[model samples]
Target: MTKSLKTLLQTMPKPLFGMGAALGLLLFLMVGIAGGFWLFDRYNSPPLGILESLSEEVLDRDGNLLRAFTTDEDRWRLKADLDAVDPEFIDILLAYEDKRFFSHHGIDPLAVLRASWQLLSNREIISGASTISMQLARLIEPREKRTFTAKFWQMARAIQLEQRMSKREILSAYLTLAPYGGNLEGIRAASLAYFAKEPTDLSLEQAALLVALPQSPEARRPDLYPDRARRARDKVLERMAQSGTIAQSEVARASGHPLSAKRHDMPQLAAHTADRLRRQAPKDSVHQTTLNADLQQRMEAVVRDGADRLGTRLSAALVLADAKTGDILAEVGSPDYVSPARSGWIDMSRALRSPGSALKPFIYGLAFEEGLVRSQTIITDQPVNFSGYRPKNFDMDYQGDVSIHDALLLSLNVPAVALLDAVGPARLMERLRSGGVTTELPEGGDVGLAIGLGGLGITLKDLTQLYTTFANRGHSTILTDQPRSSAERQADASASPIPVLDPVASWHVSGILKDASPPRGAPNLPIAYKTGTSYGYRDAWSVGFDGRYVIGVWVGRADNSAVPGITGRTAAAPILFEAFSRSGLSLSPLPSKPYGAQEQTLAELPPTLRRFEISKSWLTNDSLPEPAPKIDYPPRGAQIEMTRTASGQVLPVLVKLQDGRPPFRWLVNGKVLQANGNRRKVAWQPSGAGLSTLTVIDSAGRADSVSIYLTLP
Candidate 1:
């Protein structure tokens, strides 16, 4: 009752009346505007609207660029309107969402009034009586937030849409726009995802399941809530029967039917393959990958089953190709894959890892084909110390004086390194790159030995592709997974021979490599293979070819850490054998050629070395051939020594046969030794490490003949 309070009341009264009047006027204007828009939209909106856009593209396996797109995402959307929806689903959806749909127009005034009365009575808004048109409107114009304003817009849009399109069109839009579950935006995606078939292909029970999903897609995911979904499906059947949408027996059959939703457990094999393809075709728009469902499943089964038996933390990768065409047939990346329900990470295919000695055969074969060295050439197997790089033979022992054939057969590191040195790392790396190896080679000059030893990192895809050259007779071809046609067949048949390398040389190298891998118990089918072991046992690989298929198997831990004590022969060869065995190739032997097949000589031999000719009987015998004896010469001179091969013992006799007269002088520790009385004998003692030598002197004072000892340990 103070003066300020009285003044505030007076100020509030005058404006309050005016404000109320203005508010009433604004409400009236809004209602009038809304009403006019509704009437105009309902009466004037176009009927039988023309199609706006549509297109579809079909691609060949090579991504050879085919077709144009229609309506963005739907190249193959065969629309099934309301009349086409399996009658059971329509009944379930109508019974659950809107029992009065058929009885109402675009909006149900009674349901709206009922909803308002419930809200006024403080009851939860458990049900929405949106007619089919309203549902279609919400689908066409999705909103970020669900508010009263959104419902108002939906109602207005519904009336306009109903005038513009037929009931069938509205229902079709709803079916496609309806959200079912993850990756299932519409009835079609859900139908295929859950039932492994299309909407038209769904069974009665499946149709019920789809219709039940709109209530709660996640809570009733067929994969997650089989029981709940089944019960909801039964309710749908009952409602259909009660509503006379279907006969009593029909309802009984559907309600009592089992919910046979196809098992949606992530297909381990397919998912793994898709992951690999995704990596390979990241920007390819569409990935027409070479994945044979049957082959992939078989490979998965083998890897999973084999890993279990091996007792090691084992995993495997398998790639199959058409040997003639270089087309990949199948690929399995891993045993485990990513999924909403699963909890592990494994990307086995593209995971870069070391492919130990697996690269050896290709390298050695390429070297041989290039004529860097011959198979029979005597490559020293003795310990080699080149600069600071010293590689050891696998046995940790050197085999001295081995033929190149023996060295390669044993995969002796020194012989391979020697060949690499002869071929030059740069040239060899270029050959590998040309053969399809997309890997980083070690610095050619610095780490040439490392590359020779399989120290480079490479992905399984590239590794497999590189081996295709060997399988394809040293020709590179584009590999893919699309379907082949008769025209393509004729083109390939008429295509020119793949040009790159000498067929004879490549085949010879391949033959040698094939023999090198002597299968342990049962010989692996006539396979030309090379195995590799990287430092720290970080990787193991066995890439080879049977008569028809080229195989590459790489095994290692996923973390890029070393698998202690595992080598390529141990880890990957067995898997290769298994794959080859399953492929039905026989263990037949390949043709063999003589060592140094390209190099042989029939020319006359070089002249023999004999500095002095001598005879016996100087002391005892009466008759003997006289010796062209030795002569003394310069004060400081070199001496010749001869020794036998078996024992390091020196011989005392000098030979008469020589290119010219012997000018050799005999010297023992700086003193001139006299030729014996027989003239044939010269005093020579064992010296140096193994054997001694006798020197013969000629009239010119030049040493005529010297023979050095070659002792065998």
Candidate 2:
């Protein structure tokens, strides 16, 4: 039995042998996976925890952000909304970060192997293989130290997070946590910072940029290294195509686009406003903005043109806001924004050169709001010394006993200063502050008469907000980033609706304020406008309004250098007018009359004088009015006989005056002589040399001069 059974004994326990083999294989496999995971941990350290919590955002009425991002100071963060994001973007990121993202539970075994091989070979650290879940884990539980042990922990944590969160949740966290560029984290913030738009609104080229950025946001910064960014963007597009996320045609088309971050061009004014709004909003919530992209572009162009025409290193700041919601619509901080070479330094318009008489409207407005002045009230436009501080008008011309309406319309510095003194600075400041102006005023400083004429350093934002109150009829709602619900807002106003100022006195003051606005010589579009210039020709500003929108503009050098000749009306007001004209919002015709209002009469007009409508051609004799014959001007160089009369020398020169008025004065040898009413008669004695040139000045400040060329041959 021993010999024969020996062979059988060798095969006595086949099942036992099989069990041992299986056990050994299982142990070997377990050890290998453990080692692989350990190695993965050693090489792949978790990301550092950057932001504490997700950033908040503010949106405009149409859900467009007035400003971008939510932060403390320059802190901006955003999370991608998958529904709003481009599918190719997600696919491209997945292709780069986790090729097997869909199939893998959380970790990719083959990727670990390749990454180990590369690390051991000392080649590039290319194989990330981080699934969406893994990225989420890193974001939630980031490592304090970058070490082998930390990486293993991160992998484990990633596995755990994958088990806890859904695929969509994981993707959202990665999108929100991924860094893009320059203090901007997450796809949402990155999209807006780079594109001035949301992730959902991203174009194909823009999507490629966002996806490419996660590789190395700083190195691929489109603004800084556009060439490098272009290369990276191209790579992303290639990968996206390979992944079947984008068509080859799409890739080619996207590749052709220049790697220009137009959206991220970072409008200087918008950025400055964003910074300011961040400070004003809740620390955690995003401040939505009311920025109008079209209007903003127009304002920028206007400011730029003004600066160019003035031939100075000028900067301008402007702000437009919705009267009903106090939502800022458009803003400009400077004439030139920072080029990448400028190191991203942006000048805030609200912080630029001091606003001159631009601030007068507020002083006068507050006075009117407080029932201190009426439109027809006579305000002496003479100079006055307040504690040895005398403020004079820009022209230094005195118009004694000018109506409040006229004084303000002309922006007379002395009159404004006197009114400011009467209203008191403390109260004025309070009113301004209440209305959302934030300029610093001198303490215990007697707001001299110049105070009413923009003697203080005010910002473009300050003036815009001040005018906003007037546009809203004396009651101002606080500026907000978010669109207000009907319940949240006071009330919605239709176009052309009369303002809702309360109390008869307050209403009267509003009227005075409106009346004080410069007569916009064009057909009345329901608008109120004021112009102001600083004394040194350093700054000029215009603030105006319609029932729907309030706009403010400033024209001045960024460095406070003088612009010798341009005035606010010439520079800033025209820009404002252009903006209004381009906006296509017709002015509501002026109301026939407000309810409960009575018309008041000023100094009676002379019975002998009556205004008559006449064609301009009739005045110039260019073409006659209907049913009238055109008359010729006295034949060029014709002689005139001067006969002395009691009223003046009756210099009779036959000239044509059709249906319209003509130059009242007759000039000889270009000498401008006073006109006796609307009569073209020149009392001239031939002067020597260049043939008497005669010129005439009209009431509207227009002049016509002609050379007689009197050859006394």
Candidate 3:
């Protein structure tokens, strides 16, 4: 063996032995500490759940605060994050409290020694040596008095906190627990209360004020004692200068900055909506909604003014949104959400009330689609009866041989009911519901023509949603305020799944309504609008829409008491117009006229279409007065949620027939499913997603189909 190799081998063992011995000792110490902590974990552990107790927040689409609810303790304590806080504030806080915060484990020996010396020399407690961790322990489990025994217990808890959490976590909890005056327990609440802003960005004066308030919150309340508060803040600024946390040149400027003595009220926009979301998800700490806070505030003011001017006991609600996406931008549930006398706590926008003639446009639009009439088609607007149901005009007079445009604009009840009879009432409501408009007939009521003229109860929201079909030029979107909902899933479910009318027909209908006369003294905005009054003046509604916006207003008493002289035009239309004017959005141009839309005089039109003849044109194609082979279970424009099996296969869609001859044939997406099956029900498995047209044909070859969207829940 070489002499050098032997010498190296002799020294390697000693070095290896020393390294192994050190690692073994370290492992043994860790095991011993783990055993000790396992015993310590049984009691006196930190209350970690306290960190999770936070205020419930409601924020608008742009993260602007709309409202917030205090915790059960009646304290506004929002979770604090180091990233969301101003770094300058952190620097000022640390410099004033614990300079060796980051370097120490839990307690700083230097600080303890200095505090001890100062106490001994002065024969009294001169200064505190509590690190951020120790302060956090006291905040979590506060002591009744500042005795030496309590201090030792706080020191113990401080060590536990340091062992259990990171330095950043400890500091964040401290920031969150730091008490400000008047039930504000966090930097966020304090900032919003005093400065009407967030803690994310702070001025030097603002940071100093915040840093000094937690020391003596009540005594230094800026709103209660401005002089003491100012002195306390200035002292913090002076300390920052002395410690060089902030430049000496900045102290005078910060001190000269004035402090706000008045406390701003927390935002209270969309009170009803916030309450709704809070009830929906009681445990959620934050609810992000698709609302514009500023617009909601302004809209509420408009509602408040309208209700106030209408005198006592009359409350109004306004609902508006982006027509294309159906994102509700503003909803004023009541004029004064807290008014006890008016029962304004109720959300009138979602309450069921008679729509009156507000639903007439949808009927007319459907008629135009079915080739029953055109904009200029002449129709008799006289008293009419369908079986036992007789309807008269709202003014108790009839227009002889009036154009469809005039009939609709006048909201003649007879003409509307006449058209509804020609086209099935069930069909009209089906189309409305297909477009996401919720309507309800009286209990045990059958489908009838009276529904065309305020015969059913509908919410203002559903009424406004129906107008979106006209605003979007035939397509409809479901209104929602939830941002987390999948818009793409709803839109991509099908190709115009809920079409109210064809583009050409919707254009004709919207054009006629666009010429509707404005309420007295209201601006002649480029929008198509209609108004309605319930049978007994219990509800008045007005819904209008431009190209991109749809707004609806309701004026009535919550108790459903009729108010004399309250008409749609006089009570609701004014509020609707005011909403548009105050919406803070410029009107978008109405949809362009469709290519197939053409104006024709009676003489130039097809002989059948020259006059009102609904049964002759659309029904003639099938050569039947009534359609047969009806699919009943899954209604038109219905969305069926299919379950997936463990094998990842979608369940089959069940189809039922209301009336059909025996030995029926079923087809799905034009593919034969059940051939010559006598049973009324059948199942069809879809190959993919999107709109599926399910058709059933009876022995007589009379066929009917219903379109539905296939989705998974």
Candidate 4:
């Protein structure tokens, strides 16, 4: 074997043996490079956590920018959505920065060789071989100094980034983190700042300008150095033209385009609402709201314009929503979010305030539902005293013997209070709370007749939700601003909603309210609305609804200071009318009268509903039609011990009625308890050990009440 090996070696060609040796050395070099890369990757991973540090954004339902907040470092860095960005911009960016971005792994060797040659020929550094991935590494972990050591680590990190992320993700990171002068970063910030528009559809010249800015952001900022910025953009266009990526004609046209020397502010809509939701969930990067950007913009303008007419220290708010689904489309928290005198920082839409006559519709709705009154049923609007609680008309005058329809249309306080005195106040509050209303009541939260005349507290948001029920034919849904998936949003427009009234009674309410006069000289739109003014002119409210939309407006001083002489019809109703017109929607007619509901004239109704009369004190009548209700058991000022069963359940106290009409309803502490008809008795479980008021309302709209103390046994 030794002799044969010697013979073969002696006979082998020298060039072939040298060739084998070279191949072995090359293989050894390749393995060493692979081992080095593996170790580098294991020890120094790319700072991929920077991806999570993007600015929080709030967008409308269509993914349009509504508002955005800066990052922890106070930089305007937004994510670049490739689908929304123009594709031509991406091509121009690649042609100028890294032509071989798609083919190369992390670095382009040919470009590096060309740069080396140029540096040697010119005796100065000319260019560097930085790919998109390398640029992304530098952006996430920027180094102020330029050195070989820094370059080496940057190259290593680039390789790591490519291994961990896809090519598209790497390019997206570059687009998101690339600096564009001052605190502005990302393609989105650049476009919005310089162009005052989205990056979705960039012109040829604009695209080239954005492509050139990130290379030397501060030096080429158009707002700071217009000449340098233009030169840089022309350089990019020249390169694109030479590479056959763009036509020379296009290059010439783009070269002459002007650049703005000013920076514009980014979109800042829905300020109060966006701040609230962002604070609620800080970690969420994107919040999709139910707001309509176009409608929101229009409504904001309306509020700002109306602020001037409201005089000093006065502010306004409005909430517009879908009647059927209760999705809040446009909500203005206040006229100016930063105004000092108006206390504009306080979101008036959510702040509790007096609703005034805005709730009169609910009172009339309950009356019609209980068969106590018809549209044509006559009820006296004269001044009345209820157990020392006196309520008068808003104008301080009364109309004698008016039909129910006219009484509601006028929003007469006397008629409303009389109706509320018939129905329990507790019943109205509970009905409101069921539909997500936060009712704020005074005097221990157990209300009196004053509640029927803006005595209770409520927010514009809750008030709007209540009016949405009247428009939806008595069905009510909770108002929501958070956007849902398309499938989810359209799924249950007619699901089981909270029933504010039966269809028949709701139609009767709408039937009477549609005739309420609109703002003076305003277009007579197909809508049903009510206006209200609180006592002392503190809050003015107007809420109206077409077939498709419901809007509520409030004009007042946020500090709760009275702005005298500001009535709802003059201040708020005009705004409400304008909001619907600016909504970009044609007013839809109110719902047709539902089945089993027909307009009735006087003498066409039943005897009980013909005239709602419990007492005629103003008449010269010695004979009364019926006696007022009386609470016999648990007499007024009576204190009784509460009993409990063995199972830790409190026993209910029984209430007996006397000397009234049949079909009686009972109330305890202004809240209605379980009532029985014709039996004259009710069983009530006392809420706790305390003094409580118990009242009884007969079918004739006459009430008798008593106060009792239940002591714990």
Candidate 5:
């Protein structure tokens, strides 16, 4: 301590030292206030428990509502955001609930002062000073009673919320958690329930009514007390007009609007689809599907109508899809969703059922691709045994020899089985699997000719996909229920493409089936379709396609029981045509012929293709040799009478042959009645009633002739 230093310190004023101590104390106090605020904010943060209880929604491709599941508490707490609500509703809310909602941090002092003054001057609590943020705080941390303590806590939490979140966030929270009436929490839920629409497009009157409901949810419930709700809504309109939130004339018009008398039922279209999607998505998340609600409704109607006409215990499933994109446009799992008699709850579209003759087209297509047969190629439809496993046609009779086009158009069983044998069943199964179809073969059973006739099990969805590949020019893509995102689409584009069949083969099959006669009385459609009836009539199916769309239909007893007289041509083909008609799309023509394809008649085809020949070894080594030529009909020297009707129609004589090679020639009275007859039977129109000689010649040069006298009736 130097003497100079001591003198300088002693000259300092006592007031200056006192001021320094006061400043130090003020700095400490400031630090303490900030520390207390930080601690309070950390402890008083808004709870987000309400957000976890939001309702889950399933939407269509256009974001239209499909279905929504309520919270565990049975509350309709659909998620809401500031952008999703009508601006008019927000305006009315702020003007009526808290005018200074945007400018004030959390609490409005002027509003508090005004409320306090009114309470004191009137000796009653007439108005509330709680801003929207304060209300949000109370909503998140609900309290049973409105006490001074609760109000103070709410104000503190609101201040903390204002510091932590943006104005829009706070407003969204309020909109999402606000109560409307029983079991309706958010604006979206209330809007859907009361008005049967979205909150994003509400009228002024609807907006006012929604704004008023949150103030006194129970007392102002429109469904329970329409008059009280009208009054509350008008009060909101009055405030909105006074605050200039809306024009006075608009207010008058809004006030004159009526309140909703009852709640509306939520959207229930595509209920099964929504349920399936919800099971696959995360809880409380939104799911969007590629289903078209309108199309789905129409398909359901079609299936239901078909099922009704088919009688009891019968169900129908249908699927419609975009051929190019493989997007499932509509799916009907069953005709009626609640009919126990029909087992309607089961999703039959995904169920494994025998496809019957529905698969014959693919076999024929494969044959065409292999160059083993053509549309104009002649095929034998006579009774034939393959290793002792004989296949009989549905009618228990065969047209002895027919062109490939006629065979496929008639859906002949023998020709299809013979073709399947030629193409090898294993190859057909492999082709189907490569095309994204799942075929269920019997355990350890070899691929056999029966598979060509639908011995194997396949779902309608997979079958539809397989047919869609034909419409898509023989390329196959996976079908999707939901629209893919851009990234997913890109990834799919990078994946290797799957080829189902050659383009020419697919086109040939489509061309042949397109000309097949439609079901009786069905309007002619430029579509390629096939009908199938499984063994014992257990399942009936019809799959059809054009250039743009493919539809598959299944009708049967869900229990796999046989339904008598239920064949594909009768029960399913009509439904298939009706489905196309109800789809509301113009019929698309079949794709243009592939470059290598050329239409020709059987006589114009090459010699080898003019007749389908399989080696005796392919059939069986135990088979007997070709029988000598013989004529069984117009038996040797028998008199046959030719009849003419009143309309002057001449009747023909029937010529039948047995145990002979094909390409047989017939002669009547030395005049050739038929040249190169390929069947066991032929009809000859008698020129006159006289002695007629019928002669038959086999391709091997063996000849048999029967002469008979034709007498006029």
Candidate 6:
């Protein structure tokens, strides 16, 4: 309104002030909108979506795949890391998918501008602006709709992911989540299925195919659309060459290679063991076992081939373990896991069955430990009876007198039972139980003499564990199929060794068995072994060991049905020797004789051990004199009543005696009752119901008699 204001207005144009006001409003609105967008991105962004689920794999000790299970979504989503992948494949993937992947935080602004320019100029989408991180975000939180909203959300998630994870982690997620057709969800699964190998050792062509398949998995599946897959793979190679990521020569070679026309089945070795370990380790995605892949394969083949020749319904199981460490080297549960006729699904090694003569060595080992008998002591193999139970030789024949070594090597039942009776069955069972072997007696049945002749139930696994003691110099340990953790190893290192047998006793048994005859046509293996055939041939077993390893073989039917011709020496011993041969280890020599172990001849043994004798006080040394004989029934002057038998005849009067020198003579009414003087208990038929005299005299000419009046009922 003043003179100065009038002069300024006269200098300025009328259109200029109005245009300036409009420009200032536009600048204010633009700044306000940008500030609002920044607040929304900072506080309201979606989750990063980086923790994708993966498949669980079971591997051998060397990390070779034994089996793989699908992810929760039924997809083979094996985990992959950038370091574990082929460097060439990573390079090709980066060059083809996102060249500025490392330089950009998540979304590349320059790429977005270029793509926008192309879309506007050519009216078509030419190249994607999404970096690898952006692509990975979309994969993790997939949305089917290709709307602008979904694109914006994915970009936001990508930026968040980049901020949380390193570049290698981003690339790893991309490699892991990328689809490769038909439920195959990762680079590792794709490489294994298509090329039957690991991604770490992928060929150039294989790498390119894997790199390109994720772009259009269904349309470019190598198994279904080979031509399309080949084209896509070659296009990736061409791009790689153009970008100087790979040599031109490499591109040519890779392009010339043919695409895989079909997918391959995944590796499925050690199926039973893998399944067991997976169940035990549910939370672990990778289960590593102590199994040796090559040895397991060879042993499986050996069992299958052996089972084939053993006839129908017959199966075989073998377990090989490291003697010192108790780590199971190879375990074949059955010859053929899928054979229905053989009942192969059953793991026979764990099945409870009688172990026939396989237990004889333990009996003899216990006897030796008790000093009741030596390996060379003479034992009477003549027919013998305990009360009414008579144990006969397997052949129904007898050797008059044989050394204890012959009795054990021949698996003579009567002598073994006699020794068991002297030592007591309860004592023997306690020894086996204390050594980490489980022995199952009949339902509600107490330990009896028959158990010495395979009358109890025992599994091959426990039997093998017991045998390991001899190979381990009387030390016992449990066998493990899983790799020990650091804590477990430390615990084992500090634990005390379990004693199964005295070193001298174990050596004595092993020394005797090692000289036993081998199966016909087989070499005399340096290993010590024992054979066992159950009653009715229901189970045949052979367990052998050297200094380092113990191998046990069982051949039988799972149903417990007897095979007529099956016997340990014939059906199982040969397999035992062959298994040791295929173990791929040199034979280890047996342990040297322990100090204070007496390896004496038969004549050099003490007077008591010079000949095997069964007595209640039999455990005493030769220096002790024999106890005096005493009649158990009918005191010096007592009345006795005799009962009638089932056939309505007068039952015999049974006389029992205890503790006397051998060849004790029995006399009734001053007449000799029988010719045999060694009888401990004699049954005499009463001639008449009157006062009778029962007299027994020891070989030392000592006499003791009881008089009783008997009334027959």
Runs in model 2 deviating more than 4 A are: 1-79, 88-104, 107-161, 173-269, 274-294, 337-392, 399-404, 413-444, 447-450, 455-457, 480-525, 558-562, 582-595, 603-713
List the candidates' TM-scores in order: 0.54, 0.57, 0.78, 0.82, 0.79, 0.77
Top candidate (TM-score): 4
lDDT of each: 0.57, 0.61, 0.83, 0.82, 0.83, 0.81
lDDT of 4 at 239: 93
lDDT of 6 by residue, 1-713 (tens): 99999999999866755777899989989988678757766887644433446788877778777678888878898888667789988877888888888899999999899999999999999987888998888888899998889988888778878877899988987888899999998898998899888888788888889988998999999999999999999999898888888899999998999777989987766766776777787778888877787788888888887776666557888888887877787888888888897788788878889998898888898898899899889988864547646665655456878999999999998789888897888888877876677788878877898888889998777788788888877776667778887788656534535466788999999999899888986788899999998875578999999988888899988888655446788888888888877778788998889988988898799898999875533333546566577775545676654544334566466576655676878889999887555656567888979999999888877778888888753
Give a tens-digit lDDT track for model 1, residues 1-713: 99999998988745555777999999999999989996867665533222222222222243221222224554332234455456657766777676776666678898899888887787678457687778777755668998999898888787777666676677777676676755455675576567754465567667777887876777877677788888878877777777787688977887777665454432234455454445665544344544555555566565555444433344556666665666666665654444211121565666677665556655566566665545555556754555545566654456777655667778888667666765667666666666544666545535466677776777776777666655556654444455557677456434434333455556656666777654465454667777776765556777777545676776665655433345678667777677766654444333344343453221221222111111121121324333343322111132322222223333332222221133344555446665422233233334443433445555544454344442311
Q: Pick the winner on TM-score between candidates 3 and 4.
A: 4
lDDT of each residue in 657-713, candidate 4, tens digit only: 655666777776777675656666556777789899988887888888888777754
Lowest lDDT 10-mer window, candidate 6? 615-624
List runs of model 5 lying over 4 Å from the truth: 1-34, 282-284, 486-498, 517-523, 614-713
lDDT of 3 by residue, 326-403 (tens): 889999899887788579899999999989999898888888888888877888765343553546555444578888
Please say which candidate is ahead in TM-score: 5 or 6: 5
The number of clashing residue pairs in model 4 is: 0
TM accuracy, model 5: 0.79
* TM-score order of candidates, top first: 4, 5, 3, 6, 2, 1
List clashing residue pairs in candidate 5: none
Candidate 3 structure lDDT: 0.83
Candidate 3, which segments miss by more than 4 Å at Cα?
1-38, 485-488, 491-496, 601-603, 613-713
Write one digit per residue (lDDT tens) for candidate 5, span 624-701. Answer: 677667776656877644434334555565566765677888887787888886777677787788877778888888
